[model samples]
Target: MKHPLSQFNYCPLCGSAHFEAHNEKSNRCTECGFIYYFNPSSATVAFILNERHELLVCRRAKEPAKGTLDLPGGFIDMGETAEEGVAREVLEETGLIVEEAVYQFTLPNIYVYSGFPVHTLDMFFLCKVANTDSFKAMDDVAESFFLPLNEICLEAFGLDSVREGVKRFLKR
Candidate 1:
C-alpha cells in the first residue's frame, strides 16, 4: 500500500524538487520551508432502511471494489457537510432522497484511488427515505436494491470499512 504523500515529488507551493518526506503524514520543501500535511478526507456511508427493515445497497461500477456490494455514499466534496454529502450521494447513486440522516458512528479507512492510498474518515448514518419507488442505479452504482437485514452477507461487501460498518450495524 502506497502512502498518499509518496505520490508527490514536487512542492505544490514552491514547485521545488526538494520536497521530501517530513514525517509519516507530511512532506517538507527544503527550499521554501513549506510543509504540507496529508490528512484523512471526509466520506459518508448511508444505512438506509425501508419500513420492512431492508437495507439499501448498491453494486459498485468502478474499480477499487468494482462489482462488489456497497452502501450508497461517497467522498464529501468541498463546502459540503457530512449530512449534505451523504444525502447528495444517495440521490446521485440510488435516486433516493434522504429525508433524515442521523449520524451513527465513524470508521477510519484507506481507500485506494487510481493507485494511491486515500486516507478517509467514513461517517456512517442511519438514513430515511420517503420511498423506494423512484430508485434507479446511477453514477458509480451499477445496480441498487434492498436486502433484508438478516440476509445481508458481509463477504459480499468488498470494502473493508463498509463490511466492518455493516457488521457493526447488524449487531445493533
Candidate 2:
C-alpha cells in the first residue's frame, strides 16, 4: 500500500523520486532539499440582502453540490484582496455588483474533487449589492433568487460550511 503523499512522487522542481513527506502537510526532496507544502485555498461567499432583508441565493450548476443552494461567491483569485475577490465572485455568479461587504466569519471546508480532498478556508460576508435589478443566474450558478431569512431552509444548501454560515447569519 502507498501513502497518499506518494501520489506526489517526484519533486516538481527537480523531478527526483527522492521527494517524500517531510511532515503531514509537506513534502521534501532529499536530493535537492526542496520542500512543497499543501496549503488550504481561500474562497469567499456573500450573503446579499435587499432592504427588505431577503437574501439572494444561487443554485450551483456543478458538483460537488450541483443544484444545491449556494451563496453568490467563489474562490478568491491570486493577488486579490478578500473583499475584492468576493465582490468579483458575487458579480460573476449572480450578476450583482457588490457595493460593500462586511466580513462575517470563516469556516474550514473540505472540497473533494476527483477523489482528492482539497481543503479550503471559506470567508463569509454580508454584502450589499449596488443594484438588485442586476441579479441573474450566471457562470456556475443554475438559478438565482431571494429568500427571507425567516424562511431560509439550511437543508437546501449542499455544503456544510455554507449551511453553518447561514445558520450563524440567521442568529445574527
- The lDDT of each candidate is 0.94, 0.88
lDDT of 1 by residue, 1-172 (tens): 6678888999999899999999987999999999999899999999998878899899999999999999999999999999999999999998888999999999999998987788999999999888877799999999999899999999999999999999999999
| Ten residues in sequence with the least summed lDDT for candidate 2 | 1-10
Model 1 residue runs over 4 Å out of place are none
What tens-digit string does per-residue lDDT give for candidate 2 at 39-128?
Answer: 888999898888788999889999988999988877888899999999999888887888899999999988777877777899999888
Off by over 4 Å in 2: 1-6
Candidate 1: minimum summed lDDT over ten consecutive residues — where? 1-10
- Which candidate number maximizes lDDT? 1
TM-score of each: 0.96, 0.93
